[model samples]
Target chain A: MTTLRRVTLDVLKPHEPSMLAFTERVAEVESVDGVTASLIELDQEVQNVKITAEGAGLDYDAIEAAVDGLGGTIHSIDQVAYGEHVVEERRTLQDG
Target chain B: MTTLRRVTLDVLKPHEPSMLAFTERVAEVESVDGVTASLIELDQEVQNVKITAEGAGLDYDAIEAAVDGLGGTIHSIDQVAYGEHVVEERRTLQDG
Candidate 1:
């Protein structure tokens, strides 16, 4: 699977571990599945978690829904990989 | 116009404003042009930005590329609204 590097997310309510767990649960954006990625401590109050998943793993709308489902809000979502929209589509096919 | 809530991003390098600025610079993920988004303070060293835009903003692939273009890595991209893949596409349509 293609790797998508640092996709930064902010749990607007607070910097809590539960918020992190929510993202992990709903990582499958649209059709992409998820694999293990790593996280780094960027700051005391925030973390930088990375993962290699099937491109479909990130459903922008779905992700947002998942976050709201968990009672937390996101600030922004940035993908570190450039020119890789297919990565998301790839996962969709896989999920199918 | 519909507003998409928090899309959290983490700049793995550092908790610096420059990193934040980078996200804003390439805020146009792909096809989705950008409108104004807001950010909020969540913790000791984190921010929670929010915005309202046509679903046609936030290209997963493009946003990833934009981040890498800046040198900052992403942790993960979370969409606060679940079941909203159309948001990315809406932005794409707008861009087209």
Candidate 2:
């Protein structure tokens, strides 16, 4: 079975549980190596944010449970990577 | 009981499942009224994204399951709103 290495999600949430508190909560999830949260947009009651997480063996379910327990919803699953040793794929532009 | 109306998250994902494909998959979740995805940043192997979803009685579990099924992970719960008739909270600057 392929192990998940990294995952990205788009999430929308209410305003009370401040983003700082929320980030701290998610970062504590088991197997999550690191987390970075950036605010994309905000209105009167909600804020749109991008959640990026990376780790050796990411636990999708644990991460989900943490977000749910905190009263947040995932809008979209933006990206994913899996394998024994997942590495960021990068390539330089080749001029024709 | 409080009902969730909107949620925002920060996510990091791999490059294969194009953001468009990812968004399309997320939009299909039950109780999700609408989905908007915007690209935040990209590297050789991964892309960071912000996903916003709005709806009545939003299902955090379904959303999370769908994203995980599609190979994404929730990095952080950025914001959350709950209660009846959830309304965007906006306040004008009052003169001091």
Task: Specify the highest-TM-score model's number.
Answer: 2
Predicted structure 1, TM vs. truth: 0.30
Worst 10 residues of 1 chain B by lDDT: B32-41
Q: Report the C-alpha lDDT of model 1 over A5-81, residue by residue, as the tens digit.
A: 22445444325644347557656455446535345345665545443334522444565576567555554443333
Minimum summed lDDT over a 10-residue window in model 1 chain A is located at A87-96
Instruction: Identify the candidate with maximal lDDT.
Output: 2
Provide a comma-separated list of chain B TM-scores, one per candidate: 0.42, 0.83
lDDT (Cα, 0-100) at B94 in candidate 2: 52
Clashes of each: 51, 30
Query: Candidate 1 regions off by >4 Å?
Result: A1-6, A13-21, A35-57, A80-96, B1-96
In order, what are the TM-scores of chain A for the candidates? 0.42, 0.85
Model 1 residue B83 CA deviation in Å:
43
lDDT string for model 2 (B1-96, tens) is 778877765566677576655655666677766555556677887777666656677898987887777677877766666778655544458522
